[model samples]
Target: MNRRRFFGFLQKEFRHIFRDRRTMLILFGMPIVQILLFGFAITNEIKNVNVAVLDMAHDDVSRDITNRILSSEYFHLYQNLHSEKEIEAAFKSGKVKEVIVFENNLAKNIYSKNIGNIQLIGDATDPNTANTIVAYTRAILLNYQQELNKGSKPPAIIQTEVRMWFNEELKGVYLFVPGVMTIIMMLVSAMMTSISLAREKETGTLEALMVSPLKSWQVILGKVIPYLVLSFSITLLTLGLSMFVFHVPIRGNIFLLLGEVLLFVITALSFGILISSIAPNQMAAMLISMMGLMLPTIILSGYIFPIDNMPVPLQVISNIIPARWFISMLRDIMLKGAGWSVVWKDTCVLAFMAVVFLFLASRRFKMKLR
Candidate 1:
């Protein structure tokens, strides 16, 4: 009889587990998503990196080298530059990662003097990617030099000069600071606010507030203001540490950086409110914030991995992650010294996301109140 009772208890427990949607999502859905994301999104290999060529030589040799670099799986020809002046603009636009400049009369120098010079300029905001790109370009040039030397008396030598912009020392901290800042702000602002609001709901204090004379927006504002201040304080602290300890430069306008930070904080807070509006309790809110916001912010935001290296579907999904834009802006402002013109589009996207999130959250809050 005791054995039969134990069997019945086990069956009951299994039925309860299958019946709870949240438990099922935690047990099954999260593992599947995490495995797929780790498998596809986590990669060090670079592919289809956009590069521009300034072929001043414009001769057969220069053309051949240009073709070789672009033909490789690692690089795609983004554009042909007319002059050295266009090179800065291309890098500033953030579309072109590396620029190859062929010295004038490259073919002549190689054939007559048995020597040629090529300059490679790489955007070093992300130092790791820049190093990989430079190494790959050098390998290709060496291969071309080897091809020219087969059964020849004198081997033609190609002198390659590498220049890394924005980060001369290839500091890994430059990359980590902005990424870590984004992750920290997203968690503190979004997760804490969501959990805080969800606690009020779970404990029935939120219903008490709703029954009071305060409007929904007012209540939300009350909840958000404290977190907003906290998030801003955290940002300032991080920035101070980055500038003083890590020696990362803020070459751009300080006011612009602070403004962008403020905007991102608000967006994160609004997103937290949206999550709280949907979540049933503190645990659900915390879980959703961790699973939905934190994972995407870390993996899909190009924090550690290059977005260009990710698969197409994952890249598409990254566009929706707010941290992606914020981190890009932070890198541009803090590392590259980008001005308003360089970061305006990203600013606009964050603004749009904030508005949409607030609107949806407001509607959800009102529906729950009704």
Candidate 2:
């Protein structure tokens, strides 16, 4: 390889990419797309499901049970039907996702020491979410049943005391808001920085940067520093929304949370720089970021699914995702109120990844440009 010719080519490429108006527009748009996707499109919690209630019993006890189901925060009783036929119409029309029914002799059976049925018919299109809603509906009815049985004790009581650790109210946005924000920031920062650097090569301006007597690290830092400011500001804005708007609590030290956020940002930036070292243009850089970072962050980082329950291969794959560490760290701090004492290991892992990527990217970049 002719070292002088290669370096000359690289500098020329950098100058071209930096000067393009379209390249500049994409650089800013990346952050916005990421923020919107994480905020609106992706979520794990289900709520405000519309339900129809049918009171076949048509007695005082049945009315009381109907009121109990309607009272729950999870289900909105939009349709109260007199017969099961009305429930069929509601389901057929798709206006209601769930139908609740009380047996005809609800009070009489309980008074005569008989067990009656409370039927829950759920829409199975989204099985996972529907299942959760059904469970919650049963819980409400069971609580009412327990109240009635308070006068008489059973032989064995299978009492379940569900304690949602870290998040007391189990707000969807509580853990999700922080985790999604981390993911969006990582995607935008990494993609924009990588694409910005690669565009220089695509447009043939990198030669100017290389021939200016500026150290390789200085050039890299110049591109990186501006994005560092932007990403952190976005993080702060997302956190504020979570706290003030969504009412997500921070149970851990603020300093520690900030430290982890910075670490993940640096780690993402390093990976972006690493991608830029090999990619020849903005299109390549964008494709690499989407396929390599954004998709994995959304699917395998435990952002949408519980990691522990996943297959062993996927769980192992998730170990390499940078967002996995950030997801855990943020959830711990935001929901559980975790501190350095709890997340130091994760911090160490992220720091190590950043340093490793930085080393590889610096060497690859210097060699590629030269």
Candidate 3:
């Protein structure tokens, strides 16, 4: 009789666990999603890096080297430039990672003088990737040089001049500061806001507000304002620490940086409201914020991992993550001294996301009132 009672209790517990959809999702869905994201997203290997070429030589040797670099799986040809002046613009556009410039008489100089000159310029905003790219490029050039010198008495030397733009010293702090700021802002604004709202719902205060004279928008704004101010303060604090302690430079307009930070905070707050509207309780809201916002921000936001190196599906999914745009803006403004012209598109995207999230949240809040 005792054994039968214990088996019955075990069966009842199993049934309860299986019946709870949230628990099942937590058990089954999160692990699979986390594994897939971690497996594909966390990698140092770079692929399909966009490169521009400025071939002053336009000779067979220059063309051969260009073909060699592009043929490798590591790089893709993004543009061909006619002059030296276009290099800065290319890097500023953020589309080109590396630029190859061959001197005027590459093939002739190689054969006659036993020397050829090639300049490799890399964008060092992400120093690790930039270093890896430079290393790969040098290896290719070295292989070509070896091939040419096989029959020669004096092995022809290809003098490669390497330049790392933006972050000349290749500081890791320059890359991480922006990403860390983004994550911290997201946590304080989105996760905290969502959990706060969810707590109100769980405690029945949200329903009381719905029944009161307060408008839906007013109630939502009231919940969001405090968090917004807090998030902005946190942003400023992080910026100060990065500049003073880490020695990260903010070369762009400080006002513009603040404006962008405010915009991103609002966006994150709106996202929090949306999550809270959908969550049934504070625990669910917290879990949703962690699994949905935090993990994606850390993994898919180009914070630690290069988005270009991620798989195509993840790269596409990353576009929807708000941190991706904000982090990019932060890096451009702080590290690259980029102005509004460089970051405007990202700002617009964040604004649009905030509006959409707010609209959805309002609709959901209204439904709860009804």
Candidate 1, residues 30-118, lDDT tens digits: the string is 33343333333433347899999999998999999988988999999999999999999999999999999999999999999999999
Question: For candidate 3, lDDT tens digit of each residue in 227-326?
Answer: 6766676667667765775567899999999999989998898889899988989999999999999999999999988898899999999999999999
Cα miss at 280, model 1 (Å)?
0.6
The number of clashing residue pairs in each candidate reads: 0, 20, 0
Count clashing pairs, candidate 1.
0
Residue 21, candidate 1: Cα error in Å is 34
lDDT for residue 76 in candidate 3, whole number 0-100: 98
C-alpha root-mean-square deviation, candidate 2: 6.5
Choose the strongest candidate by TM-score: 2
lDDT of each: 0.81, 0.74, 0.81
Off by over 4 Å in 1: 1-170, 367-370
TM-score of 2: 0.76
The better-scoring model by TM-score among 2 and 3 is: 2
Each candidate's root-mean-square deviation in Å?
A: 15.4, 6.5, 15.2
How many Å off is the CA of 49 in candidate 3? Answer: 31
Q: CA shift at 151, candidate 2, in angstroms?
A: 8.6
For candidate 3, give the lDDT: 0.81
Q: Residue 84: error of model 1 in Å? A: 42
